[model samples]
Target: MSSDLQGDGGPDRPHAQTEGPAPGAAPTPPARRRRNSYRSLTSRLLSADAWVDTALWRAGRTIGEGMRSYDRFLRRFEVRGFSRAAAELGSDGATFGLLGLLVLLTFAQPAFEATRNADWMTTEDFAVTFLDRFGKEVGRRGIVLNDTVPLEEIPDVLVKATLATEDRRFFEHFGIDIFGTSRAMVENLRARTVVQGGSSLTQQLAKNLFLSNERTLERKVKEAFLALWLEANLSKRQILKLYLDRAYMGGGVFGVTAASEFYFRKNVRELSLAESAMLAGLYKAPTKYAPHINLPAARARANEVLTNMVQSGFMTEGQVIGARRNPAIAVDRSQDQAPDFFLDWAFDEVKKLSRRNPALARDRIVTVRTTLDPALQRQAEQSVDSVLTEFGQARRTREAALVAMVPDGSVRAMVGGRDYGKSQFNRAVDALRQPGSSFKPFVYITAFLNGYSLASVVPDAPVSIGNWSPRNYSRGYAGPITLKEALTRSINTVPVRLSIAVGRPAIIATAYKMGITHELQNTVSLPLGASDVSVIDMTASYAAFANGGLKATPYAILEVRNSAGQILYDRSRNEPEPERILPADKVGELNDILINAVENGTGRRAMVDGVAVAGKTGTTSAYRDAWFVGYTGNFVSAVWFGNDDFSPTDRVTGGTLPALAWQKLMAYAHAGIELTPMPGVDPARLKPAQVARTGDGTPAATQPRILSTRTAEVLGRIGRSLDALGQTASAGEGVAQP
Candidate 1:
């Protein structure tokens, strides 16, 4: 305010104004006063200029310093934030959380858990009946059960090879190796794809069990989390055990035990280092690296695993070199061609059982011992091939289905088609077609059960219903014939008349009791197989007659075990209930009539050389379907031949292709089995025929009833002449008098 306390040089120099103030006016009244005024003005101007310049310079310097500090702080903060975020992303906590989420998600879905319930099976443990129905699907192969081996029992080679190929730091890592993960990340980034996984054996097991193989950040997070959780919950040895049991190997082999049997037909403990390396190589892609498909690639991968083992100090260099020089490991390809159909069926059963009891459906290995006789299965397949080939050569028919079963409802062999590999459509279980006259047995049996004996007479002449007249296959009736003869000949009119006599509902009920669960039409024509039924159902229903009067449901699996050799379910017959729907005597009678059918009826072609067989032939309208369902003393076989499109086949009768196929199949089935006689009705209980005579033993004016074959022959000649003349044969109008 005062310029250094008004020290402006302290007025030391002369005031240099030098202006002539008013000229000479008063020698300037007091030079001191003027000087003071001038000094005040100068001080005010200097103070104002100094204040403005100093304030501006200080404001500019402050702003520049603030901007520089802010820029430096922002760069440092950003760098630290990014590094923290990356570190957190790779932390154990984050990995564990991710894995926990994946486990929860996997358990949330039914399909993932459903695969666990699939029934497993070995080559034995099946009954002859089961073998007959599904044997063809099995062939002559055996399935080894998946069993856990102790650490000591596991081959050192396998242990070392897997460690070398899958995780070099398996022993050191807690669950995941940070270095391996970083390397994997770098490799993945460079390759622009997920071509590398640095997951340890534990991590891989975690991913397989809890996380999907999907490549995503969220999935990786989940995998990491699960890996940590698995490590915490399970010890290293336990994790390795799980890894060995759950890992996939080539040729449909799922675990180390399965792989050993699949590749070398030996136990897991018996594998050499080279063999272990070969099996370890299958982890990359089991089917792709299967010895059966690509031997060279498999061998190369095995050698690489061996080399890695040597480098990892698990194997000596000489051993690696020796393994590399060894010839390609030989594997039996025959074992690989297992019966897929049986496997599928067993899997279905396993699923059903598991669904019924969910405790057996999770985290357990299951082995199913089924009723599959490999010998019978092979014979069944060969029979199918032979029959199909015979028919194919004659008539380009490439499709056929056959089902063989024991009378106790055990399916032995089933061939859905010629080539199961080309197409997996199981025609035996899926295809539905008309049963044709093969269903007539039920109708006649219904009549027999309803008081009409086998000796009862039925007119096979032209018969008419309300605007619907049924004719015989031969177009001409055999005249008055015995019920036995009518059925043996498969006369349509006799069955139609018999169905009318014994209500249609009675036949339907009988058929249903025999395992014909398919919906049948409530019409008069149902006696001739107007309803659609699957081959399996038809064969099973007929098998009821073979097994006396008790009905047995067809089943394939006897027991199921998990991958850990734990029994998940057992379908054994401790005390199987009998579903009795028919009288034993009636069944026996029906059995007798059916036996006669094969012995001397339309199904005569189904007879084997030395076996007493009984069955029925069915020919539908327009030749749309043909079937032959027959049974030996111990087995029942059903053969169906037709076009898949439901189109008519040219002149393909049930007695033709289907009957021949049944014959060929039965020949193989009865090769070693002995034939037994069917039980028949007691003759003493049957009432003798009542013959009415007119004058001189001539026929009476009443109904000229033809009861026996002798009388039927006389009536048939007269009926043919009368039918030829276009005149209806009235009762008691025989040409020759008796």
Candidate 2:
């Protein structure tokens, strides 16, 4: 190529060296020509280096000129121009930050959806105040205070203690404290467990208001977003107020005011520093630190709160020293051992009644006048405790339940277990146990409904149905015994025979109509009390006989009124009247038989002096359960003794501890109460040792054995027919229920 075309024609350029051939010359040997071409290329590259330097110098001059022009242009405004540019840049950055924040909020739609509940806008859905039948305040349930205490009204020490222990940086952050969270995370990582929570007070309020106690990532995300939403909407004061007002304090209490009143028996405004510290300590776990349950633990927790206040610079050690020296002591409630079990049941009833009435539900606060009798409740609790304390170890039983009600089905007292603190299982209302011979009344009532009188004869012999045979408790048959006598002895085979004779369905129908709510299975041993039933249900069923053959449905709440004195539910005004379930004569006959059972037979231990008692005893197979359900003219009560695991005791018959407990409870219940005659019961029969006499001036042996010879023959034929029918039934039915 020519130098002129290559633009390599400079006068100061060095001459190109040639090894063999020159430009445009004929090619020499191929290798010699190639070497010559490489040398020429090297000569041109060395020449281009100088040209490249000149070009770079020219470009540098051009850039210098442009920079000088820019400097001259900038010199017009001087320093002010730089400041304005920086301000504009900062403004742009702020706009981008706002947009980024909006984008982050967009990801919180799920949290917004989770926390949105219209009901939460208000303080509470409902608060319940419980009163006894006499309109005296025995105890309280639900949110006790209808109105939340203002933050200004709360003690300064309480607020300080709460902030110190719960969230020290409560006022320093917006919903989520990043610094606090990071510190907590590091600490948790070092410890390998979550010993400290990083949630702010606002976050805690959000969780309390809208979330459940769940430790899940999804729940945490929702809690965070809701906390942010709360911070955005509410001031710090409002958030703190809500946190204090909605947090759960123990003893079925919510909010500082209720907790103060519950533990110290005073208004929140009157709380001392020590009491305030105790209440503040319950924020982490209310049940764990409830003063009424465990005073020492509560005091220890309060001491921690006081120390936290000192460390947080809210108080000096001297200021908290008094609380440490003598911790707050709760009022002695020894006289008022509140029947918590009955109250719980009554609270549930209030909820149900409120749900049924939309207006009541909207009221959100009510005073329930329940059928509970405080004195009777105390007596019941004492009776159960005494029995379990005296005989529980010897009998190998750990639990006992007692339920007592008026003849009108008003539940006066209920003792769920020996100790309410150890367990909360309400055996009186929730547990179902086999009724044993106590269920025989339904079978005998069926016989009466079918035109068979108590004087009718029935052979109490060993009875067989398929592979199953029911024998008497003594394992010996009492041949040709009157129905009344059979029931008095609690003969199992006779009731089974009666059940088969009267049809098992009829017996079940009778039980249901009489107030047994449990679904009874139609089995061969059904009349022998194979079905499991609650003590409350059995008591209510027996109340029917006391209520003159009318179905006495069990009821706890007598009246419910709102805070504004408007009646929401009145049982007498709202509930339908009970219908007559059994004829008067049949009820009378059945009552006569049960009277004899309690007065002269197995249930004699349940007898109370100067009161007409009628009831039956029930002992389940292997002594797994023992029950005595008895009633005086004015009250009906049922007592049960058993183990929670369904383990058999050391042969505790119903006539033993259960009957004695029933007697104690009845004696207390019948005191100071006018005795009313039980429906179809002779008032004289209630007196001790006052029984009908037979010929020769002796007590009647088995109700005079009143069945005629012809009646006996008819009954014998009927018994045979029942045996055949029971065998057929057993083939179709399954084995008996335990």
Candidate 3:
């Protein structure tokens, strides 16, 4: 075996016999010598199996000793020595266990700072009741906050219904119900959706009382801790009472007492079982299950609540069968007919006007006497509905808004939308739409302010400002038309020419002075109504002309009074006097032009018989918005029609649906009421026997003719201004028309 090992020619052994190199021959190549050396080294390594075995065995022994030492250390310190150490530290086993619990609590007590805010408890202390011009209840908002009922006053069935649907194990559990939580988790996992919540009543109350509705682990921890504190501090009855009082029931009310009154028109103690179940259903999602909004869905939710009562053993199926069969019916408080839009606007007005009196502002419950005339409001709503029902599908129009107020700015009627329940957005007050030709009156007034009159003539040929060429509605222009005829025809080029002559800033300043609050963009299309303006603002601006150029800022609330009949705010006492914005002569000229338009031009559909009307029609690009804003001696109303998504309609112009609706509403509004002649208008001109004529014994809106010498001088200056404008456009300094 030793010879076999030695003869292997490994690197560790020498060769016994070897041949020498030939004389004068080349030595071995480096590559071939390296191969031989590698083979020898590899063979030597292959023969040393015992070395690898010894190294691994030594390593295993060292690892075993280290592991045994670790185990012994754990046994001594963790098991036996810890007990002795605790005793030395003057702590028994119970004391140490308490310390461990305290450490756990320290980690869980991070949300303790949330308890400092106690203001939420009094959030429902204010309420509002709305009335029309006459003292009849139209609607209620907020709550009768100071009228919180005690627990004993609440009907037993209502309490049981709330507990059954909200928390089945309310009395048995601590703050957090572990069994309920586990059950919820298992059920949610089974269904793959969150059908039920795990929070107890105390947890919900804790959130409503002191926390916001944020879904985070930290918030959940805070909720759990706060719930525990509530349970420890208050009795079960007190917690239940507080939850019932503070929980938000639907329709701008808080607490069951207010909800019962708002929905059933009765007290909490008078709620029947069916009504109780209905109110209980609102606790989950008040808006979703509000009976005033969707009665069928509310009944379905109430049926579910009844089922919950049965499953929770609070009542038998037979006991709940009556409620399930005869579901509750909320009081029919004219949900469809009530002036919700006007009420919403008037409520805001009340809050704003009340700020003048600190005592009035601090009052918890107040009655708002609004300026809304129910008769006119009904007519306005009907007019909008009739138009929509007739032409909505044909025109592809889905929404419309109308605002009607007196010349003095007392809002008489408003129809915000088709239905206030489905959408609370007050379109008349909130929606900003591009007024098409309806905006031309502002331009005409500006022209009058800039020394151009109704008789002043301008060429209506095709015009261009930079790359933007504003085309007329017909995509054609008439040549050399008087300003009266230009406005009467709602032509596009004349306004653009007039805008360039007078400048855009002057026009914007005139519009602002006339009560337009929205900012106007300084674009070439400003005369064409490219900027957005709200319906109310536009109507109020027109009222300036009807009011003999007086500022007619729209207002709704006439008076605000507390529950005790004490007047908190009276508009006549609190509001400032109207300021004159337009000169009487200028107002007369603009009013004459608008009246001519209604009589013989685009707004002919808006004219009411025996009443002098002045208005303008507006239609935007692609037929997106349509408007007809008109005013008589008594009232001013603005009507708009469009799709809510800003989609184009099927060629619905301002003279079509909008004008027709305005005519219907205004006709009805003027039927019984005494008609007041519009300022700057001659009632005699409205007579069929008479015709308005200029100083030359010629009709005001006769055929277009050559410009007079004085007008020629004005046109000459306008031509020079146009040349400068063209130069600016050529220099690439003009803004593109929208």
Candidate 4:
């Protein structure tokens, strides 16, 4: 009322026009002057008529009066009053009343343009779809979870709480409540916001079940007519049940029972008073009152609902106080069991694939082949289970996430969190965490590409740049260490010194080339992993090194064939071969250092039998997070462990949980496969030589790493670039270290 937030709901605002005066208020004109004018006009007319024909007019008036009296006398026997009208309808008046109301509403509702499809009148039968990846069913989607509870089965307190909070005069009124509407109007006027919906529960049900939510006069009028029709056709209990079953409860949830289970993990009948009130509060705005999203806001809304219930006489004041004091505990249902972490990740890709290809929709059942290897998925799951089971009790807050991809950028497995039901957030792809020392490889690799070497004597002593002094993770530094030794020890000051030497832009560019898509802050501490990134990118970047410097975009879907056996999409057919993003021989030097890191340094925990591998361990400041990124001949994997709330763990390091999990999973992934040397590395030169039964080993497990003939040419060019580095002056120019 103060401001027109309530104006026609035109693309600009969200309210309706001002409500008109109460029905039957303006019948005639203002009193005194209007009455005098009417009498003067009548008198003037009569005076003029008197001169024309007095005798003829008098005779016609007499006949007219006699006819009028006869007509009035005859009409006395017809149905004229409410009592007579009811008696005339015979028996079963409610039935006839309902029939009349339906007919009226059918005509009236359309005048307001608020009609619904026939299907809305009944329940919907939802369909389910499962996406298969690598001969395994990976994910399920599109199943509607709606179950109706009968009014009799619903708890009495819940019913009272709902009516009191939503519409107290539900049973008292025929369909609309004038007093409630008046109260809402006054409150809305006072608050200067649409603080209350002046609609009854029946009106709410009608709108929710069939109508659009555009606030306009026509919509309101249609809603009222539909409410009347519903009231006339269905019992009050039936209407209430329908409302409870169809209400939207946030996050694609619908209905009381489903919402009850979703929020509290309880049945409707078992809900406590405070729980019922909280649910009633959610009806106004589910997103605003979702306890899981914001507990305090939800509690405040529940208190307001309790006040309404007490004011409406549904509960006593004492009862309201007691309910507030003994509020029910909410469930911590953050994740689910079925889909796990990676399934949700892949399913998202499937949905996009479903949209792009027309044939995917032609069948009721669509078959999608993702790059996920079922064996690796199980290994990842088992690894997470193994580490958590062994170390979880002591540090119960810490949860683990893992992602594995082949050198060609095909994701084989991913575990987002400890439990998907408790939380669906994908930490591997969505979470942004400081990479810490895990990011050092990009700096070393950049330095190597810029003519530095694994044996480059990098200054590791503590130093200050202006007012900022960077320290190692152990708060101590080793002096004049080789770049490989610096990385192997996970030295923070050395990487920082190396970052400043190579230039932060060069380091950032190096990371970008290796598939880091997140924005990296151009700061001195960037080499110490001050910038945040997802695990998937880190894993994919390492895949570039595994595949001998080729740029690989990480992907999931392998093939999508419709039920008709017709091809819709195939990765090999649709996508072009990957291009190299780094020099092959230079990457070979970086790879040697990383492989040594795994075999002899901080990542020693990540080593497995029968293969030479490479990885790094990263422990952030204050033990906030831990990460381990490693790769083998066939696959690259990144693992992380931390609290979801970003709280510091109990001295957890990347070497402790993450490295061990990676070792177990990777060892299992290559159980029966022949040991093959990583690309860009000499098998005989690597520690404990990698020899495979197949003379021409497969670097991608099933596919060749250097597939295209053009890729071999690119490698040939990289080999020539390394040969030129020894003669160039750029190799001897030493940058000033901090």
Question: Per-model C-alpha lDDT, please?
Answer: 0.70, 0.81, 0.82, 0.75
Runs in model 3 lying further than 4 Å from the true structure: 1-125, 150-255, 283-294, 309-319, 332-336, 688-738
Model 4 TM-score, all chains together: 0.55
lDDT of 3 at 328: 93
All-Cα superposition RMSD per candidate: 23.7, 20.5, 19.1, 25.2
Candidate 2 positional error at 632, Å: 2.4
For candidate 2, the lDDT comes to: 0.81
Q: List, residue by residue over 680-715, the lDDT tens digit for candidate 2.
A: 876765554333332123332221222322353356
What is the Å distance of residue 353 in model 4 from its true position?
Answer: 4.2
Q: Worst 10-residue stretch by lDDT in candidate 2?
A: 700-709
Best by lDDT: 3
Tell me the lDDT of candidate 1: 0.70
Judging by TM-score against the true structure, name the best candidate.
3
lDDT of 3: 0.82
Clashes of each: 34, 1, 3, 10
lDDT per residue as tens, model 1, 323-355 = 788844747574444655655565555555655
